[model samples]
Target: MEKRIVTVQYNYDVAIVGSGVAGLFGACHMDPSLKVLVIAKREPDLTNTSLAQGGIAAVLDTVNDNQEDHIRDTMIAGGYENNPDAVRLLVSRGPADVRELMELGAVFDRNPDGSLNYTLEGGHCRPRIVHHKDSTGSEVQRALLAYVRTLPNVTIWEDSLVALLKKDTCFHLDVIQEHTDLIRHVNARVCLLATGGIGRVYEYTTNSKIATGDGIAFAYRLGARIKNLHYIQFHPTGFANKKDRETFLISESVRGEGGYLLNAEKKRFMQNYDPRQELAPRDVVSHFEMVETKRQNSNDLWLDISYKPADFIRQRFP
Candidate 1:
C-alpha cells in the first residue's frame, strides 16, 4: 500500500473515477454547467467495455419480444437472485437506451429493411441483442467518448489512477499519475467510481487487465454496503491458453449462432447437461464444462463453427 500524501488539490462538481462506458456515458448525461473530471488508470479505451464482444441485451423488437419475457429470462438466468425491480427496469428502459446509443453515433448491425439486427445469446428466449458485429462494447465506448469529449464541462484525465478516496463534507480523492510519484488531491461534490470487475484476481479470465475490483475495494473501505460479491459469472468459452492471465473470450454469439462445443474426442457433450445445451446460461454451461472436464479426465474442449460458410461467418462477425 502507498501512503496518501496530497501535494495539490483541485475541485470539481463531479468526479468519475474510471473511463469505461459507465463513466463516459454518465459524463455525457451530466448537466453541461457542472465541471466534471473523469480519471482513467490507463488509456481511456483500455477497459472491460473495450473488451466486451457480446452485444447489449434489450427488448428492442416488441412484436417478437416483451419486457415480461425479458425479465423472466433474466431472472431464470440469474437463478432468481437478481433484483426484480432492477431487472424490470432494465427490460423496460433498455431499448430506449440502445436507441440513444444509436443517436450518439454508435452503430449496430442493421437488417436490409434498416431496422436494428437483433441476435440471440445465451439465456435469452428471443433474439434481442443489438450489436456492432462482435465488438459492440468498443463501438459504444467510442461513441460515448466522442460525445463526452465534445462536452465543455467534462475533462478526461487519462493515465491517472485514484489512489485514495475519503468523504468529508464532500468526496476527496488522491489521484496519482501512472509511473509517477506525485499525488494530487481532488475534491468533488459527487464521486462516481465506475472501475470494473475482479477478473484479474482469477488465474485466467476474459476480463480486461484493469478489472481488478478497485471501485469495489474503495466502496468497501468507505463502508458501502456491497451485495452479490459472491455471485460471479464464469464465462464458458475462453481460448484454452494457460500461459496468459488474460484469456480471449470466445463470444457467446458463437454458440448462439449454431457453433458446437466438443470434448477431447470431438464429440458434443452439452446434450448430456441441459436441453438448451450451448444456449444455456453462462453459469450453467461453465458448471457443466468443469463437470465434463472431471469426467473425461482432461480439460480439452473445443468450440467448432467450421461447418458454417466462411463468407457468412466473416460477414456475421466482421
Candidate 2:
C-alpha cells in the first residue's frame, strides 16, 4: 500500500471522487478555466448510474405536466419527509438540467412526432419520465462522459480510490492507485463526493459493487451532516434468482406501464391495498411485499407483464 511512483504532488480547483452521472455532469458544468479532477474507484462504467433502467423523473413537458404536480408527487412518494428546499430545487431546476443533458448529446426515446417521449412511473400523476428506453442512466452517463472528455480543464482518473480524506486549509485526499499499488495525495480547493448509495449492505439489492456506504462514511468523518440514512427506498420487483446477491431489477416502468404484482399463489396483491394497484411508489410496494411475503411464509413474488402484446414489450424495452 505504501508503494511509490513518485513523490510529485498535484493540486486542483475541484476534485470529484466519483465518475457517476452527478460527478461527470458537475465536472462538465464547471468553469472551463478551473482545474478539475474526476476519480473513479473502478472502471468508469461500473457506477450505479450506468445500472439505472428506469428513466429520470421531471416535468419536461408543460402541456401535460407541471412543477407543482411533480413536486407534490415527489413529496408524497417520500412520505412528505423530503426536505422542502431540496424538493423545490429539484422540481424547479430538474427540467433545465435534463435539457442541458440533451444539449450535451443525450439521445432519449421520442414519439412519432419526434418530441421527447414520456412514460409513467410509481407515484407520478402524469407520464413525465424521459428515458432512453430501459437504459436511460447509461445513456445519460455516456453523453456526460463524452461532454466532459472534450473539456480541456478536466482530468479523469479511473481505478483510483479515495482511501482517506483530511482537511486543513484545503481538502487533501489520499488516493490509492489500483494498478501501481501506490498512494497519491491530492489537494483541492473543493472535494465533491458523489459516490452513490449504500445498497450493497442489503442481502438483495440492485446496487453496484461500489455502493458500499463509502461516501456517507467519508462525509460523516468530515463532520458533514448525514440525514435520512435510514430512509432506504427499495424496489419491489427485483428478479429473485437463486444464489446471486446482486439481484437484477426489472424496470419500474413495467409496473408503471401496467404490469401486475403477484404473490406465490399468483394473486394480485396490490389492488386490495391501493387504488393504483401495482403503480404505488416503490417504497410502498416494497413494504407491502415484505408484509405479504412474511404473512404467506414465502419469498416467491413476481411481476408479470405478459398480458401486453409481445411486439410492444420488445419495442418499448428494446
Candidate 3:
C-alpha cells in the first residue's frame, strides 16, 4: 500500500473535522464523486470512538425486540427530558445505520446459531447492544477506517488540527499541521464538525485526549446552535492511576456479563438503590457509586468480574 503524504493545502466538496466514527461515517455517506477531506488532531484511529468499549445501542432484532421499548428506555434514562422527535429519529434510523456498518465488513458478535448476538446494557430492557465482544467501538472504527481508506475521493489528514473555522459564503478552515509546523487554509462547500465528546474538560474521563470539546467550541465560536452543554456522562469504572489523567475505561459490558460493584465491605449495594440494580443507566449507576463511595469513605470501588470464567473474560476483553 502506498502511504499518502500529509499536505498543507486542499479544497474539497466536504470538509470533515475530527476523523472519529462520525466524521468517517459522514465521509462514507457522501457521493463517491464528491471530494471529501477528513482532519484529525492525531492519527485518525486515536479518536474517542476508538476508546469506546460499549456497543452502539439499536433495536436490530425486531422479532424479539421493538423500537417503542427502545424509545421508552431512552426517554426514561434521559430523565424524561429527551426530545421525542430526536429520540424517535434515532431509534428508527439506528437499525439502518447498523446495517450499513455490517455491510462494510464490521463483524458483530453472533450467537451459536449464527444470528447477531445482543447484550443488555444499563437502562435498556432488551438485549439491543450489537457488539464485537467487549470492543465494539474498536471494531466499528476499524471497519469504517477500512471502508474510508478505499474511497478515492476521501482524503485523510492525520495530526492536523483545525484552529478555526472562517465562514463568509462558505466555511474556510485554518488547520495547523503538526509535522511541518505549517498552517493552511482549506475551503469547502460543506463542513461537518464530527468531533466527539467534551469529557476531556473534566479531570477524569474515559474519552481520548483529542475529545477536548473542540467541535463544540468551534461551533459556538461560529455562532451555531448548541444544546446539552451542561449534560455529561460519567462511567463508573475508569482505570485510575496516581497521575490523575487519561483514565482507561473498564467497559460496561463487564457489568452486563455479571460483574458486580462492591465497596470496601464487599457488599453489593446497587440493589438498595434501584430495582434494576447493576444494570441501571450510566448516570444512575455513577451517582450511586459516588454516594456509596462517600458513605464508605473510600475513593475506589471494585468491579468484580472474577465470578465469570477467566477464559470468557480473556476471549471477550483481550
Q: Residue by residue across 11-41, what tens digits does model 1's lDDT show?
A: 9999999999899888988998899999998
Once fitted onto the true fold, the runs of candidate 3 whose alpha carbons sit more than 4 angstroms away are 1-9
Better of 1 and 3 by TM-score: 1
Which residue pairs show collisions in model 1? Answer: none
In order, the Cα lDDT scores of the candidates are 0.90, 0.89, 0.89
Clash counts for the predictions, in order: 0, 0, 0
Encode model 3's per-residue lDDT on 229-284: one tens digit a residue.
77888988877775867898998988887889998898899999999989999999
How well does candidate 2 match the true structure in TM-score terms? 0.96
Give the alpha carbon lDDT tens digit for every residue of 189-237 in model 2.
Answer: 9999999999999988998888898888998999999888888887777
Worst 10 residues of 3 by lDDT: 2-11
> In model 2, which runs have C-alpha deviations exceeding 4 angstroms?
1-8
